[model samples]
Target: MKQLLLIIMLFLISVAAYAQKVYSVDYQNQADVKVFVVKYENQADLKVYKVKYENQAGDNNGKWFFTDYSNQAKKKIYFVDYENQADLKIYFVEYENQAGWSKMSKKQLMY
Candidate 1:
């Protein structure tokens, strides 16, 4: 019984250690957008991006950015450090199919 209990405890600990979480963020102070802080166990990197296609210069590409300076949702494609959770806003933009960075707009972001 002692060995069995030890095995069970080990299994639970391993499962808890390997779990990863996803967060949703918004610029509002209200509860409309589901936002949560990420606490990494160690040195790690988390990326957030929007996957979409739009006609621009006759090309296509996958799009992703860390965080832009402003939360206006209408601006260029830029990345800023992820600091304040309240300033985070989901921005969306259109880009050439599989091309690269293009014009970023507020409408391009989502949950």
Candidate 2:
């Protein structure tokens, strides 16, 4: 039972570790993920929430922090002018629980 519990814990840890670490890039060409901010929350593929602490960010939960340097970020993202040009369309949610990916296929774009 202990071994099974350990395996389950490990699986959860690995899953949590896979959540994309995001960074804001200066230029679009330098970014790994291109994002667009949608006007309406219903139109967004992902709902984002800015977290107060960096440690709180995880699990497609939209906990984001704007890092000062590019090197400090895990996944460098560029904000695009048009939604059609973006790899992911996001809406900033006021509440943390409201943040999550609406499109499962687009999840890979973050990682």
RMSD of each: 15.4, 3.2
Best by lDDT: 2
- TM-score for candidate 1, please give it: 0.21
- The sequence of per-residue lDDT tens digits that candidate 1 reaches over residues 1-111 is 999999999987653332211122343332333322234312112123343221111111223322233342222332324534422233233332332223243122322
TM-score of each: 0.21, 0.80
The TM-score obtained by model 2 is: 0.80
Which prediction has the highest TM-score against the true structure?
2
Least well predicted 10-residue stretch by lDDT in candidate 1: 53-62
lDDT, candidates in the order shown: 0.31, 0.80
Q: Which residues of candidate 2, in runs, are more than 4 Å off?
A: 1-20
Q: Can you write out model 2's per-residue Cα lDDT over 1-111, one digit (the tens) per residue? A: 999999999987865654545778879999988999999988888889987766777866676766667776667899999989999999998998888988888877765
